[model samples]
Target: MITEESIQQFSKNCENIFTQIRRDVIGQQEVVEGTVIAMIAGGNVLLEGVPGVGKTRLVRTLGRVFDMPFSRIQFTPDLMPADVTGTNIIVKGEDGNSQFQFQPGPIFSNIVLADEINRATPKTQSALLEAMQEHTVTVMGVSRKMKEPFFVLATQNPIEQDGTYPLPEAQMDRFMFNLIVPNPGLDELMAIVNMTQKTMAEVAEPVCSGEELLKMRETANQVPVAEEVMRYAMTLCSATHPNSDCASEAAKKYVRLGASPRAGQALISAAKVKALMNGRFNVAYSDVNALAAPVLRHRMKLNFEAIADRVAPDAIVKMIVEEVGTRFGLNPKKEEAAAKAESKKGLFSGKKA
Candidate 1:
């Protein structure tokens, strides 16, 4: 069970993490928060952005903020699966006889930074599927469990299509959140330049350990969800599928493929953490709405019509959210109140006439 004291500690730990991350990251607060939430929820994150937008730097800062072994794999076309998930090598034994020994690769770390992950081939990218989902790497029929608090924070270039391969749907579904890192504003740009001029090195310090992070995840799992709110989350995820019974108009029109079952699991798990972060003891409808985009954007496959009309996934998600909210009467409290007030005004005007 979650106690008040434990909740306070969780919030404090989150605050310390953000404080430390700010020391190295300049802007993109949403991306930072989403990444942290996914980390605490024990899920992988995929960051999409153009070059030089602090995507790699943010991952490095997270490594510093968490007292864990960090490894950076600069993904390229020439990269091979063996380079990522180790292979057995022949080595001399004590008696000078050659024997097969397993050599672990960079994947055997607490936090892995797969920078420019899309640059690698599909075959090489598939190497991470098992590790990301099962948290284990299989080599030569042998499986090795990942260390505690393991996370894969991958970065990719969105605009650069040349020499880059699109992440397969199976691999994409493994991610909990696909955060889009946008360009910094003028003030943020100045701050980043000034900070870098002082030192390019990451100055963030570790505030949480692997054990403590796991504890936080455990605590988040205990945050209660009301039945209505739970059903609403399910409805939102179900509505993403155009063929489903609860399909929204936006989904039927624009989406070619909906999110996988993992998306619903990720939605609730992350919402629990989000509630705890805001000092709430229970999950709310607002939490689900706030997280819908990052959780579903990469998971859904937009049709050619959507692309031809220049309708981005985010826009489709927004329309689906509104439609579903209306269908389920799950709009935010403020919106509900405004709607009631408008109805009352029309009623009074009709009575006066």
Candidate 2:
């Protein structure tokens, strides 16, 4: 059970972590917030953008925040499955008995930085799929559980797909958020230069521990998600479909397919955490709308026409949000039940959700 006191503590820790990260990184508050949200939710995030956008810096800063064990795998074409998940080794003991034991690989770390994840071959990439999804790695029929609060922050170069294997859509769906770390603004860039120029920069210390992070994840689970809020998340997912009347014009033109059921599930879960991050106990449609882009960008597949038209998935998501965001009045106190109760007094019943 999560106490109000504990949530206040977690939020303090979150802000402290963000402050330290800001020392090394510049602006892109949204990216930083997305990382923290995913971490608090006990879910992995995929950072997608061009090179040198501070993806590595963000992950590294996050590692220092909790003093969590960090490991970076520079994925490449030659990277192998055994290289990632570890393999058993034959050993001779003093008893003159031959035994095989598994040596844990980088996968055992609490925070894994999968740098240039797309550079790896599909075969090598598959190694992480099981671990990321199940948090367990099987070696020689033996299953080994990963450390608690394990997170995989994978980065990919958007412009350089050559000699790289694109992540499979199925694997992409496993990530909780597909964050885009955009280029810094002029002021942010100036601050970044000044921040990095210091040869002796007093940097982040571990402000929290794995246990504390785990407790926060439990708190996020306790975050209240109303029934209608769940339906709103589902509706957002449904609206992504080209066939849906709610689909935006851009979606109808660009999307040949829509988000999967997992998208809806992720939207609700992430929105709950987001609401809690903003010091709220209940999920809000605004929270869901804010998260729709990051949650759906990697999950939804655009058509060939979209590629030809040079349409970004972010635009489609914005279209959908604008389509559905204001439809539900943004009343802080008039919750789902209250809205429905008031609806009974109206001619249309105000439409449940």
User: Lowest-lDDT window of 10 residues in candidate 1?
Assistant: 344-353
How high is the CA lDDT of each candidate model? Answer: 0.88, 0.80
Top-TM-score candidate index: 1
TM-score of each: 0.93, 0.88
For model 2, what is the alpha-carbon lDDT of residue 309?
A: 82
Candidate 1 segments whose C-alpha is farther than 4 A from its true place: 332-353
lDDT of 1 by residue, 195-232 (tens): 88988888899999998899899999999999988888
Q: In model 2, which regions exceed 4 Å deviation?
A: 200-202, 243-250, 326-353
Q: Of the candidates shown, which would achieve the greatest lDDT relative to the real structure?
A: 1
Residues 235-334, model 2: lDDT tens digits: 7788888998667666788898889887887787777677766657888776777778899988878999989988889888877776665565444333
